[model samples]
Target: MKFLIVFVALFALALAAPSDKDTVIVEQNSEVLPDGYTANLKLSDGTDIESSGKLEKAGTDEEALEVQGKYTYADPEGKVHTINYRAGVDGFQPQGEDIPVAPVA
Candidate 1:
């Protein structure tokens, strides 16, 4: 009785959940090699991302992957934003209009 009612309620809620059918990948491209890789994606939701990584200082003790990429997306407020970034020994550094800047002393 009680258990049956709970099961039915849970089933109903599950059916009401939103589906991701609308958020499809409109375009995608990628390539990989022994030293590096690249990727790009565009989604129906108006999000785009492009990235690539290269082996830097290869065959050396300081060898590392240097990555560079950018992404653009729209916020819930309907405002579109773009960000460019790099990652490597220096760490992930991102630049965008929405990113805050520290006030100079």
Candidate 2:
């Protein structure tokens, strides 16, 4: 009877244990552009949901490459947004309306 009770408790614990599982799928691709290279990535949530981005660059200045690219994706609310940018010795600059003008030094 004691062995039966212990076996029942173990079985109950095993049934209550959570299963470790991940169901996200990711796919990626890349290619050489005329002036630079571009890469793409995709992630799927199994419910027709996904996100992606890309990066590319070209031209060199003082051992630095002028990097520029844009990425767009839809949010959970179905609103689409994009980010265009450039980066180099001057640092990362985003394309937007509110340009930060340097105050007269």
Judging by lDDT against the true structure, name the best candidate.
1
66-100: candidate 2 lDDT, tens digit per residue: 45554444445656555556655677776533345
Q: What would the per-residue lDDT of candidate 1 be over residues 1-105, giving only the tens digit for each residue?
A: 223224333533343233454566778787776687777777777777777778878888998778788888776677999988887889889899999978999
Relative to the true structure, how large is the alpha-carbon lDDT of every model?
0.70, 0.42
**Tell me, what's the RMSD of every candidate?**
13.6, 19.0
> Count of backbone clashes for each model?
0, 0
TM-score of structure candidate 1:
0.76
- When summed lDDT is taken over every stretch of 10 residues in candidate 2, the lowest stretch is 45-54
